[model samples]
Target chain A: MKLKGYRRPDGRIGIRNHVLVLPCSLCASETARFTASLVDGAVYIPNQGGCAMVKKDLEITLEVLSGLAANPNVYGTVIIGNNCEGVQASLLAEKIREKTNKPLETVVIREAGGTIKAVELASRYAAQMSREAGMLEKEAFDISELILGTECGGSDPTSGLAANPVLGKVSDKLVELGATVILSETSELVGTEEVLAPRCKDEATKEKLLRIIRENEAHFERAGESLRFGNPSPGNKEGGLTTLEEKSLGCIHKAGESTIMDVYGYGEMIHSKGLVVMDTPGQDIASIAAMVAGGAQLVIFTTGRGTPTGNGIVPVIKITGNAETAQLMADNIDFDASSAITEGRDMEELAEGLFELAVQTVNGQKTKAESLGFNDMSLARECNFC
Target chain B: MYGCVKLHEKDTVATAILPITSGEEVHYRFGGQELTVKACTDVPVYHKLALVDLKKGDVVTKYGQKIGYALQDIPKGAHVHTHNLYSTMPKEASTQEE
Candidate 1:
C-alpha cells in the first residue's frame, strides 16, 4: 500500500516534517526547549546525557542524540550544547551530518554568554528551519519504505489474547508486504526464547538472540534481583498475568509469525528488513525512544491497562483489548481490539482494520497521543554516569 | 457473545470477558463446540477460570503454554490467580515469602 510522506534528502520517507532543537547535554536542555517553544513547527528533547559520562554511556547517548536528529521525520536540526560538556555541539552536529545531509545549526550555551542569548540565537535558526520544513512537499511511498516498531505495556490478559495477537497479524502482514518491523523489549522475551530462536534466519542470528536474552537475565542476577520479581508488574498481575513466562508468551505474539531477519543492540540502526529484534529494557518509553532513534517513523503500542506515551518525533498508536479501558481511556487509545473478545471479531478482519488505520496515521491522521502533544523521550543507560 | 474465551484448545483455563459471579453460567467455544460451565467462584473481569478440575502442583496452561502451577486444588470454573496459582519462575527478592 502507498501512503503520502515527506521524502528526506537521505532517501528515507517520514510521515512528519519537524525541525528539531536538540540539546547535547543537561545544561543546554532548557535552552533547546525554549528555542523549540518559540518556533511553530519545532520539537525538542531535554536530553539528560552529554557530560561526565563513562565510555559505554557516552556512546549510547551520542548514538541516540545523533539518531534522533537524523531521523527521517526531522527536516533539520539546531543543536545546543554546554561549551565544556564531554559531547560538544560541533561534534554532535558532525555526527548527525554523517547520517543525513539535512540543514544543521549549533549553539554553545557558554559561547553564547548565557541561556537567553543561546535560546534567542537557536530559536531564530529553528524558526527558519521550521519554515523550510513546512515548504517540503509530501510524496507517495509504498509500505516497504516504512519501519514499524511494536511495543506493549500496562499489559493484562486481554493484551495477550487479543491486542497482541492482532498486532502479530499486523506485523506479519507488514513483513509480508516487504516492510521492516522491529520487535523490541528483550526483558519481556525471556521465557519465549525457544519460540523466537528458531524463527531466526540463520545460526548466527539465532545465537545472537539467545545471547542477548542471557545477558539481560545476567544483568538482573548481578544486581541481586530476579527477572520474575519485577516483571508481571503489579498492574500486570492485577490484570491476570501470573508469571514472566506468561507475559513473554503473550508479548512475543506482537512479533507475529514472521521469520526473524536480524537482531540489533538498543538504539542501533536497523539495516535489514523483515522482522528484527532490538535488545531493549521492558520500560515502555525507553524502548519506544530506542526504536524511533533507530529510524522507525511510527510505533504501534499495545496496552491493556492503558498509557498515553508518545515520542517527540514518531506517532505512537495505542491499542487496547480491554473494552472498559478502551472506553474509559478513549481519549488516549487509538484502536480498540477489545471487540475481538467482546464480539468475537474475526482476527483477520481486525488486523485489516488496524493496517488501514496505520496507513491513515502515516498519511497525517493525528493519533490521540500526538493530538495531546505527548512527546516523552528516554535513553537506556548501561551504567551510572561518571 | 461468550462470557469467557478460551485462547487455544489445549489451554486449561479461559479468561472472563466480564465479571462472573458464583454459579453464573459461562459459555465458551472449544473445538468448534460451545460449552457451558458454572462459575464455582467469583471471576473478575480479565481473570482466569479453571477449564477443568485442577490439582495442586498441576501445571496451569493458558494460551497453550505453561503460565504457572495451581497452588491448591481448584475445581472446574474456580478463579485462578496469585492466591491459588504460583509462577514456575523464580520470585523477586523483595516479594519472596519466608
Candidate 2:
C-alpha cells in the first residue's frame, strides 16, 4: 500500500508537516510553549526532566528531543532553552541537525535577554520554518517506509481477543511488507518473556532480550518492589483483570507473531527496520512519549479504558476491543475492533480495516486525537543526580 | 464469582475477576479443562487464584507473564494477592495500579 508522505532531506518520511518549538531544558518549557502557541502550525512537548536529572535521565531526554526533532512529522524545528541547563539548547540543535538537515534554529533565553525575547526570536524562526514547510509537497511512499508503534491502555478482556490480536495481525502484515513495527512496554512483557525470547531472530538477540528483562527485574529488586503488584490498575480490576501476570500475557499479543529483531531503551533511535521492542513504562503518556522519541511517525494505541492522549510530533491512532467502550467513548476511539469479540468478526477483517485506517492516517487523515488537538506528552524521569 | 484470566499456557493460576470469598465455588477453565475453585480469601479483583497447588516461590503467571512468585506454599483454589503473591523478582514498585 502507498500513501502520501513528506520526504525529508535526510531520507526519512513524515506524515505531518509541523513546525516544532522544542525546549532544550525543563526551565525553558513554558517559553517554548508560548512561542509554539504564537504560530498556527507549531507544536511543543512539555516536561520536567531536562535539568537536575541524572546522566541516564538526561541522556534519555537528549535522545527524545533529538528523536522528536528527527521525527518525520516535524518539518523544521526551533529549539528553545535556558543556557545553563544540563542538556544545552545548542547541543540539542546540533544533534537534530545531525539527524535531519531540515530547517533548524536555536534560541537561548539568557542570550536572547529573557522569555519575551526568546519567544519573539523563536516565533520568527518558527513562522519562517512553517512557511517553508508549507511549500513542500507530499509524495507517495510505500507502506514499507512506515514504522508502526503499538501500545495499549485501560485494557480489559476484549483487548487481547480483539484489538491486540488485530493489531498483531497488522504487525505481521507490516513486517511482511518490510516495514517496522515497535512493540513497547517491557514491564508488560514479564510473564510472557520466555515465550517472546524464543521468537527472537537469533540466539544473541534472544539473550539480549532476556538480559534486558532480567535487568528490569533486578532493578525492581533493588527498589524493594515488583512490577506485578503495581499492575492491573484499578481500571483493570474493574474491567475484570486480576493480576499483573495476566495483564502481561494479554499485552504481549500486541507484538504479533514476528521475531523481535532488536530491543531499544526508552528514547533510543531505532536502527533495525523489522519488529523491535522498546523498554518503556506502561503509562500511556510515558510509553507513547518514548515511542515518539524513538522515531515512530505513527502510533496505534489500543485502549479498553479509553484515554484522550496524543503526541506533539506523531499522530496516535486509538483503537479499542470493547464495544461498550467504543460506544461510551466514541469520540476518543478511532477504530472499533470490539466487533472482533462482540460480533465475532474475524481478526483478518478487523486487521484489514485497521490497516486501511492507518494508511488513511498516513495520507493526512486526522485521527480523533489529532483532530481534538490533544498533544499530551511527558518525558520519563527517574530522579535528580548531582 | 471471580473470573479466571489465563496468563500463559504453562501457568497454573488465573487472575481473579473480583474478590473471592473463602470457600466460595468459582468455575474456571485451563488448557481446555474446566475446574471449580473454592476461594480462600477476599481475593482482590485483579489478583491471582491458584488453579493447581503451588510450592513456595513458584512463579505465578497471569496474561502468561511471570508477575510474581509465591511467597509461601499456596494450595489449589487459594487466593493470590499482596499477601501470598510477590513479584517474580523485586523491581520497581507497581506504577500501573493507578
Candidate 3:
C-alpha cells in the first residue's frame, strides 16, 4: 500500500505528527493540558500515576509514560512534572531520550513556581515543537513501518465466529507483508497457551508467552479472585459469551496463524518484527495504552458489541460482525464484517477491503474513534492506584 | 441457505445467524457437507443450536475445544446456552452456586 508518514530519527515511522505535552505525574496534568490548549497542534493525556506509586506500579507507570513519548505517532514531547513526584520530570525526560532523538523539552511546576508560570513556559516549548513538527514534509512509507496492535472488546459469539476471524485474515496478510502485529490481553488468553505455544518460533519466546499468561492468572488467584467473576462481563453475558474459555477462544483468533516471534513486558518497546505478544491487562484502554507505549502507531479493534475506546496518540479503528450492532453502533464502528455471517461472504475478500481501509487510515483517513475526539487511556498496574 | 454456523468440523453445536423458532428446519454446513436438523426449541441470534444430542454431563464443544458441560439432556437442534450448560472453570468466591 502506498502511504506517507514521518520517519523518526530513531528509524521508526509515524502516521500522525503530534506534538505531545506530557505530564510526568497527575500534579502536572493541568499545566500540560493548558500548555497543549494554547498550541493548535499539540496533544496531552491525563497522567494519573506519576506520583506516590508503589514499587511495581511506579515501574509500570514510568514505562508507559516514557513509551508514550517514544511512540512513533508522536513527533516530539514537552514533559511537565511536579517537583516531588515519584517520577521526576528530569528522569522521565532522560528515559524518553534513551528511546529516541525526537525533540524534547522539560518543565518542573515547582521550579517554575506555580501552575500559571509552568503553563507559560511549557506552552512556549510545545508551540515551538508543534511549529517544527509542521515543517517536516511527508515522505513515502509503507506497511513495513507499521507495528499494528490488535484488540477486542465487548465481544460476543459473532466476534469468535465472524469479526475476529476476519481480523485474523488481516493479521496474516499484514505479517505476510513484513509488518509487525501485536496481540495482547493476557488475562483473557488463559486456555490458549497450548494453542499459541506451538506457534512460537523459539523455546524462549514460547516460555515468555507461557510465563506471562501464568503470571496474569496468578495475580487474580492470589487475590482470592477468579477471572470468570467479572470477565464474560455482564455485557459479555448479555452478548452471549458464556465463559472465559469461550471469550478467549474468540479472542486469540485476532492473532491469526503466525509464528510468535517475541513476547514483551507491558509497555516495553518492541524490537521484534512479525507477530508478537504484549503482556497487557484485559481492560481495553490500558491494553491499548501499553501497545501505544510499545510503539504501535495504529490499532484495529474488533468488537461484537461495539466500543468507543480511543487513545490520544493512536487511531483506533473499530470493526464488528453483528449486523444489528453494525447498524445500531454505526456511529462508532468503522468496518462491519457482518456479511461474513449473514451472507457467508468470502473472508479473504473482506480482509482485503479492511486492509485497504487500514492503508487509507495510515495515509490520513480519520477513524470513527478519532473523529469522535476520544482520548481515553489507562495504565495496567501491579497494585492499587496509588 | 444456512440458518446457523458451525465454526469447526468437530463442533457439536452451531451458532444461529438469525433468530430461529421451534419446529423450524435449520440447515448448517458441517465440514464440507450441508446438514439439516429440526429446531426443537427457539434459538436466539448468536446463540447455539445443538447439532447432536447430548446426554447430561456431556462436554460441549465449540471451535473443536471443550467450552463447558451440559446440565441436562440436550436433543439435537435444541438451543444451548447458560440455562442448560455450565462452565467448568473457577467462578467468584460467592457466586459459585448455580
Provide the TM-score of chain B versus the true chain B for each model in turn. 0.89, 0.70, 0.90
RMSD score of candidate 2 (Å): 6.3
| Model 3 lDDT per residue over A267-333, tens place | 9999988999999998889999999999999999999888888888999988998899999989899
* Residue A188 lDDT (model 3): 72
lDDT of all predictions, in order shown?
Answer: 0.85, 0.78, 0.85
- Model 2 off-target regions past 4 Å? A228-246, A384-386, B1-98
Write down the TM-score of every candidate. Answer: 0.86, 0.79, 0.87
lDDT of 1 by residue, A290-325 (tens): 898899999999999999888889999999998999
Q: What order do candidates take by TM-score, descending?
A: 3, 1, 2
The DockQ assigned to candidate 2 is: 0.16
- Model 3: residues with Cα > 4 Å off, grouped in runs: A228-245, A384-386, B8-13, B19-23, B28-45, B49-98
Number of clashes in every candidate structure? 0, 24, 0
Give every collision pair in model 3: none
lDDT of 2 by residue, A109-196 (tens): 9999999999999999999998888899999999888888999888766676567877888888999998999988766776556568
Identify the runs in model 1 with alpha carbons over 4 angstroms from their true place.
A228-244, A384-386, B8-13, B18-25, B29-98
Ranking by lDDT: 1, 3, 2
- Give the candidate number with the greatest TM-score: 3
lDDT of 2 at A169: 82
In angstroms and one decimal each, the interface RMSD of every candidate reads 2.9, 6.2, 3.2
